[model samples]
Target: MEQVAEKLGRPDAGDAAMGKAWGIWYGSDSTAKRRDEIAIYSSYRDTSMRVKDVKQIRITSNAFKTQDGLATGANLEDTKLKFPDIKKLSSYLNEKKDTVVVYDAKKEGIGFEFLKGKSISLTVHPVNTAVNDTYLTLHPEWKLIN
Candidate 1:
């Protein structure tokens, strides 16, 4: 994709909606372990319209391979997964630097994530699914948009 997110990645900690589409972060590179998928409903991307396929979420990173972010010579410290904070998230979003969407965070779903450098567009239910219920981390910096 031409639009690559800059500040997003596997967060060490925090918190998506469904049918609508929201951003998500993960600590592990792959969704191998207890993968948690969240359904995105409404977001800055698709507005109030609810999408049909809530299972189309995608996750990736530049540090991985010939894809998103991992700049040349970037070490673990640079791409380390840290807990997310609402404030930090707002700051990142405010800067318009790290734009990403994590479509899944539910306890037993396939666990879909858009990573840091990419924006995920999916469908979600705004009334049923809550934003705070699925936070990226408990950290103060990982902010969630309501």
Candidate 2:
């Protein structure tokens, strides 16, 4: 921590703040290191998500599919924030029979479209962009099959 604070260069000279300065420095370094580590690991995992190996999942509206007679939503929320698995698909369409594929990498941080009607689609997370490649499909399923 002291190393971090010293690098920050506190304005208050001769004020016994070396330890605090190092703390700031180490904090910044810790965050940076963690971010880098995540990026590296993500890259390593993405290599296996090939174009021919994506498990396809069809998207449906709020009232389309039923899992044990329950509703499931997979609505399109935004496009800018998507990290479509490029290796898995090309693009999402509104047409029927459109097949979409998503990687397990994005199983979290994704939201649903419960009780609403709008555009729905699926894409790989940003961390899996290379794996998804140009393949981010939009398939709508009218019914849920076991």
**What are the Cα lDDT values of the candidates?**
0.31, 0.27
Model 1 / residue 144 / CA error / Å: 2.9
Most lDDT-accurate candidate: 1
Candidate 1 lDDT, tens digit per residue, 11-38? 3322343333344455353644433332
- Candidate 2, residue 71: lDDT: 26
lDDT of 1: 0.31
Please state the error at residue 138 of candidate 1 in Å: 4.1
Give per-residue lDDT, candidate 2, residue 89.
Answer: 19
Tens digits of per-residue lDDT for model 2, 20-137: 1101111224434221100000111244533222222223323333333322333333221342421221233223534333322243322222223333332223442333332221
Q: How big is the positional error of residue 65 in model 1, measured in Å on the Cα after superposition?
A: 16
lDDT, residue 17, candidate 1: 38
Query: What TM-scores do the predictions have?
Result: 0.21, 0.20
Per-model root-mean-square deviation over C-alphas: 14.6, 19.7
Error of 1 at 143 (Å): 3.6
